[model samples]
Target chain A: MKHVIALDIGSTSTRAALIARDGTVLDHLRRASGHERGAQAVAECVLDFIAELRDRGLRKYGEAARGVGVAVPGAVDEGRGLALFSANLGWRDVPMRSLLSRPLRNLPVALGHDVRSAGLAEARLGAAQDKDRFLFLSLGDGIAGAVVTGGRIESGAHGFGGEFGHLRVRPGGRRCACGAVGCLETVASVPAIAEAWARASGDPTATAVHAARAAAYGAPRATRIWRQAVAAIADAVVAGIGLLDPRTVVVGGELAAVGDILFVPLRAAIAERLTFQAPPEVVPAALRDTASCQGVALLAWDLLAEAQR
Target chain B: MKHVIALDIGSTSTRAALIARDGTVLDHLRRASGHERGAQAVAECVLDFIAELRDRGLRKYGEAARGVGVAVPGAVDEGRGLALFSANLGWRDVPMRSLLSRPLRNLPVALGHDVRSAGLAEARLGAAQDKDRFLFLSLGDGIAGAVVTGGRIESGAHGFGGEFGHLRVRPGGRRCACGAVGCLETVASVPAIAEAWARASGDPTATAVHAARAAAYGAPRATRIWRQAVAAIADAVVAGIGLLDPRTVVVGGELAAVGDILFVPLRAAIAERLTFQAPPEVVPAALRDTASCQGVALLAWDLLAEAQR
Candidate 1:
């Protein structure tokens, strides 16, 4: 059985998986990324993970890995195989595909934006499988999105096609880390939500999970903070609907773990904001963390197929 | 010379042109659309316009029109040749292409959304000709838009992809005609600007042009009103860049005719709002009212080419 290696190089940690061509995860491993050391070290970390995964695949399957796929957080120029900029990885203009494939003899490498890879996974094997057009938004410590059209993610002219979280929802509301005032990220990100809740509830160490628990228990201050974050997210959704007219909106990330506390009011808020626009169905992400792994593996398999042709 | 009939079926009037195969307007005519009569009358008006254009082309140019293209303002299913809805035209689910093509003898007909057709024109021969990705926004008495990518307008899943004006920029600020609160249309449209200026200056008869003149002359009250409208439009641009990351933004319609009074400040405001997102070049529409006519003609030409293949 042929297999492909999918590497999800995240900010804090890296997840590597050996996936069969039929979309099954045969084996997977996770370890700290050591990105704090800088660009070269991060590249080394990804390279080491890929090397280990390839060796494991060769031993277990009696065949060398077919290809390798790397999904990273940031603005990526996929056509040029460059990871342009990633706040989390603290890297710029890193030639990801070339760097990762340098140590291998003839392994083909495919690189893509993390969220877009996950969106591809969702479109093929998860909740958005049937949706021809949808916006997949991941609200974690920060917010990001993937714009899927006609069963493929659009990389846009500059590969910034689906930066929904950077949308200015509250103009003059809060200063964002990206140097913009009142971006959706400033108000609705996981840390932002937790900080807002902590300030309002006078609990210095309150986490987003704590806020969600309190809100679920009908705590007024926690509820207010949650609603504010939901409203901000809803505003971004409404703006997204107007811009993309997606058939569905798939919400993922840690914030979505709050479940009904986030989605219930989000749906209501989006409904209220809509007029002539058709409101898309807002639902939670189905695949969770493994989405990028499967998606990139599929992408690697596609590359291998293309190479054969 | 062979020619095609391009008809722009707008709310108030219908404009038709006999366009040469090489993209020149050979002959043109315009008349009231008679939409106030009924949907059937509107359909007849389009048919009549096409017949006249075909006759003129045969008599003067010595060639019968090969095809017809109709651009209507609404949600159009271009594939099905259906004009799904138009608020100003007060029509719903009209099979425009089929109705118009019924009387013709094997003449292929194409239909498209008016703004999207105009956007196609801009992408091919107008302000956005050099831009591979751009948003064409027309701010008239009402606001509409077209999202052009790779030289074609993206008709989203529901054909509302570029409904930029409907975006909730103010959120609970003003009631839009679409029954939404704080939409960009309610704040920056020509009528909206005129109404705000009229209220502030206590001049009921003041139009958008008058407001522009007053603002240009440094009238304090008019300047304030103009700035407010510009700010709202800038906010919409900021949101657009975050979502589409287009290379350019083409401003059309009556409000864009205000010239530097709008563009000068709009540029500054957008520049201020932008951070990580690339600031797109905002320019005026070059083709003016002739855009839809030219664009539909192109579409008709494309249809003819396709049918031959």
Candidate 2:
């Protein structure tokens, strides 16, 4: 029974899974990412988690795991196996592959961007399955996107391709953390929506989910906030459609969990904004939280295949 | 001397060339496109031009031309060999390949978008030569762009990819011919700049060239209009850089001919707008008017290679 160890290191949580070649999760583990402790500590925690997952796979499957795939947030140099920069993790140019391979006895390691890895999973085994060209957007704490073409993710020349969140949808609108004004993330991301809803509704702790529910219940203020977010997202999506001409747009992350609340108005807004571009089908992601794990597992399998060749 | 007959059908003129496999123009011809006469007449003129170029190639090379590649404006269904629609040529769903092939005794015909083909030429033989990932932007009467990656153009799923001109830069601004408001084309295209310059300079005949020259000479009105156009163009290019992350941005078409006038401030504006993304080299195209013909010639050569395989 061939299997691989997959790990996804996000901002707050680290997820590990023993995945079979067919994308089934044989076992899973979760832990606090501890990114607040510092980058080195987080790296140590990741290594320990991978070791635990590998031991579990060996004990159950009675064989060694084929390879390890690690999906990290922020800019990555996949070809060089470096985690270039991650604001969430406070890391820069961490030699991830060498650091992992040393303790793992020279096991092959594959490194990829977390959002892009999830997009690969969606393209191959989830929402956009069998789609050769599509855009994968994750509307989470901050928005991120992946442009998949011909079954491969376009990482661009400098690993900055598909930076959808930074696209300026509203000129001179809001200041983003990335030092850009009027970025899509400043208006449509989960935190952005929550902040706007909280201010408008006078509920200091209101979340995006609360805003969606209020909008669904026909609250004018919440409806306006949700509608503005949806419109901004649609504007960015329309711009992406004009540039990429994708066949489908697979959206995931926290907001998509509300289903029709986010999708219904989103679809309508996109249709209203489109003029000459072809309309791409907008659908929810199927894999949910485990998408990055599954995607990284696929990367591990690819590494094994490459090693064989 | 193996060669191909390449024809570029623009709105005002049809240009033909006998091109060697190495991308050299062995011979060239030009005639009125006759698009004003109607779609049918334009199609006839294109076919006639191709036949004439084929005869010339045969006479000079002492052999039959291998294939024909036609570069047309507007939407193109390259896989189906159909010219889907062209606002300039006023044609829709023209069976370009069959029409040319039948008259030329079953010679293979390749159909391509004029802007995309020109981009291919720039990618392969012009300014972006040796660059595997780049964006080729033609700033003509209207702006158009092509995203070239891994030595191939991304035509998108619906053939509408690289519609850079239609990217919305100013929200709720002037309406575009494509029925969209605030498109980059409405503010930065050659005609757009020319119109603004004409109105501001109180000269109905003023063109973009005049605006560039006047701005160069420090004329206040022309400088203001030129700066506004450059700012809009920079905004759109910044968006493209965020999405595609190309290594180079090759600027072509009529406006690029202004040399330092367009490149100087345009480069400065892009530099000012970029934040986190990698800055791509902004350079002028080398092939000029012959780019589309040479690009279509490359397409013709590709078809021949495919047939041999």
Candidate 3:
């Protein structure tokens, strides 16, 4: 079957997958991202990983992969096919598409933002399937979001459209790393919750998962920290709803893994805060960790489709 | 000269215009909206106004108007051609398009929200011309907004998109008419500022314009009230910037008449608040009060083009 090679490169790990035209994952692979080595080394590592995936796909399918799609964290100039300024990867204006294409003998390559790519995957094949308008939020180490309208992500005028992490939910509250006070990321991001829980519970290793478990069991301190995080998230979501009026809010990331513990309070908090704004169904992401891989694969297929046209 | 008829119906007055294909207002007329008389009376008045404009168009141009577009305040279901609800008009489920169509022997009628239509006009021919993405804010008796992306307004899933006024900016600060606390409208809307200024200055007839003038002159009380309004508006605009990252923000309606007094501080406040998000060019609305009429005219032309297609 005709297929594409997809890669989601993060700070800690690189996930590679073979995606068919129908979005099926024919095969998957994972490896260290090697970003700590240096930007040049990370680039070389990515090229090598792509080469390995390509050789495997050629040998197994008896043909070459049609395209390559890579999802990278941080600022991206998707129109220019440049991975611009990723602090995690320590790269600046890396011509990722061209780099991938040269080794693959001119295969079409699509580069996308990691969170946005994941959002596209969700919109097409996961929780938001058939939903033309919705907000996709990833509450990982930091919060990120994508506004999907007409089944396409809005990349904004300068490709910075969905910077939901820095939205100031509390006036003059916690200082965010982005130099803003009361940013949603400072209160509701996975690490933020984990840190709060760790301090409050006096357990150095207490994570957000532990906090959620404790909150679910009705522990006082954990429940307080969990509720604060949930309220902050609801504030940001309500702001999104007011601006976009999305029908669904598909949440993905580490916090989302807590399932009903996060969603139940999130829905109620959002509902309680809303007066005139339409309440969107706050649902957990369906694709889990493979979302970016599947999403970039879909981008590859789209590139091929556009080329055909 | 081929043209379209356009009308903007507000609570107190209705403005009508003759618009050329290139978005010029050939002629204009105004009349009392008579909405206080009842929804039926308002509907009858609308039909009569359209008939008058149609007859005038035929007499002046020796041809019938190809289409008509009406901009109304309140909830609108543009896809279904229904004005779902308008508290100002005291109407519900008004089949506006069909009502206008039946009387004019089935002339095409396009229905749209007042602020959104104004935003469309701004995007096409006014302040935001050539801007594919921007936020259009109208600060009148109440605040309303439109999210224009790719040169079209995002009406949301349930026709409630772009309700920017209700966004919680202060968080538990003021009770809004919409039953929400700290809504942007509560602090920055025309009447809100006016109320604050009136109370502080002990002038019963004081308006937002008086406060702006006094603030410009550096009057202490007026300046305080004005600063509060500007800060609140800046907060809401910053939230919009974080979410959509628009290229421009076009401010209109009554408060915008203050010009430099509002724009100068607003730009500074927004700049101060923004950390990592791209700062959009905040500008005054070029079309002023006639934006809705021109926008509906554009919509009418669009309907005619679609019919030919």
Candidate 4:
């Protein structure tokens, strides 16, 4: 049974998985990212995760992995196998795939943008699995998206195709870390929601989960905060629907975990906002955290196939 | 010397052209669309325009024409050659290609959305001619865009890929014709600019050209109005840059005719808004009004090729 090592190198943690050729997950592990220790340290950590996955795959499957796929959260130059820049990981121009693959006897490596990789996985094996044109948005600490068309996520000219988080929903509303004003991330992301709830509820230690719970329990202040967040997200989704016209919009990450609490109002808001454009089915993501792991594994398999050809 | 007839069915007028296989325009004609007369009349006008171009092509090129392509302004289901809905033309469910083709001895007809067809032309023969990934925006009475990637316009799932005009740049700012608040079209389109300038200058009969001229001549009120329009346009461009990440952005239509007056300020505003996203080279459309005609011709040629294959 041929297998590939897939690693999702996130800012918080590095998750490694051994994916079989038949799209089954054999084993997986998670480790600290070491992102705070800077680029070189983070690269070493990713390599360590890859080595552990490889060893496990060899012992279990009795075959050295055919290839590896690494999904990085940043501006990735996938063709060049470089992690161009990531504010969260404190990395720039890191030759990610080369460095990670060098220690593994020069095995082939596939590097991809995290959201796009996740989108690919979703399109191939999750909620958007049967949809040809779809959008995958992960609303976590910050919001990012994957624009999938014809069963593939568009990487754009500069590998910046799916940066939906930065779409300015408010022209002069709030300043973002990216030096842009009124970015969608500043209004609808988990941190943004938490901060808004903290301000509204006058609770210094308020979190997004607390706000959701409070809103669910019919707290006025938390409801307003949650509604505001939902409105902003709906606004962004409306714009996305108009621009991309995806058949289905699959949302993942922490915010979507709230289920119907978020989706019901979101659908209504989007419905109110849209006129000429057809409203797409806004659904929750199928795969949770394991999406990137499986997605990158698919990319690795594709890379292996291309190398053989 | 096989040629194809291409027609751009605009609301006000239908422009027809005979295009050679080598992408040269042989002859062309324009006629007022009797859109108010009914969908049947409008279809007749389109057929007339095609017939005239075909005759011209036969007489001049001395060869039997290959096929016809029509670029329709509205919600079009290109696969079925159906003009699903069009606010400007006041029509719905018009089987445009079949209506015209049935009269032309059942010659193959290729139908496309006007903006997407124009984008295809731009990608192949206009300002974005050399770029693989680009965006073409025509900011006339209404704002429409073509998202060109890999030299092909993304028609999206419902052929609404590049509707950049509808992106909610200002949430709850101004009411749009599409029933959305703060759409880019409400702020940056030619008619919107004209209306704003009319209000600012207290000139009831003011138009976008008048505003451009007044701004160019340093009229304070018109300059302020024009600056506001430019700022809004820049905001939309910023969001577009973040989302599509095109290599180039080509601005066309009547507003683009103002040249440096529009581009200078627009470029500056976009530069100010962009952070991590690479600023695409913002340029004016070279073919101007002829883009859609040539673009539809290209689509016709493509259809001809596909039919032969």
Candidate that would win on DockQ: 2
CA lDDT scores, all candidates in order: 0.85, 0.88, 0.88, 0.83
- Predicted candidate 3 versus true structure: per-residue lDDT over A38-126, tens digit per residue: 76677689889988888999999987889999998877767788887675578777888787677677788899888999999999899
Q: Provide the lowest-lDDT 10-residue window in model 1 chain B.
A: B147-156
DockQ of 2: 0.84
TM-score of chain B of each: 0.96, 0.96, 0.96, 0.94
Per-residue accuracy of model 4 over B1-309 as CA lDDT, tens digit each: 888888888888888878877667777788898899988998877776666666777788788789888898877777788888888888888888888888888588889899888878878887887798888888998888887766656777776777888887776689998887788888888888888888988888999989988999999988888888888888777777777788889999899999999999999999988888878999999886778878888878888788789
TM-score of each: 0.95, 0.97, 0.96, 0.97
Q: Model 2, residue B169: displacement in angstroms? A: 0.9
**Residue pairs with backbone atoms closer than 3 Å in model 4 (clashes):** none
Q: Judge candidate 3 against the unseen true structure and give its global Cα lDDT, from 0 to 1.
A: 0.88
- Candidate 1 root-mean-square deviation in Å: 1.9
| Candidate 2 residue pairs in clash (backbone atoms < 3 Å) | none
For candidate 3, list the clashing residue pairs, or say none.
Answer: none
Clashes of 2: 0
How does candidate 2 fare on TM-score? 0.97
| Interface residue Cα RMSD of candidate 1 after superposition | 1.4
DockQ for every model comes to: 0.71, 0.84, 0.80, 0.77
Q: Which stretches of candidate 4 lie over 4 Å from their true place?
A: A202-205, B202-205
Best by TM-score: 2
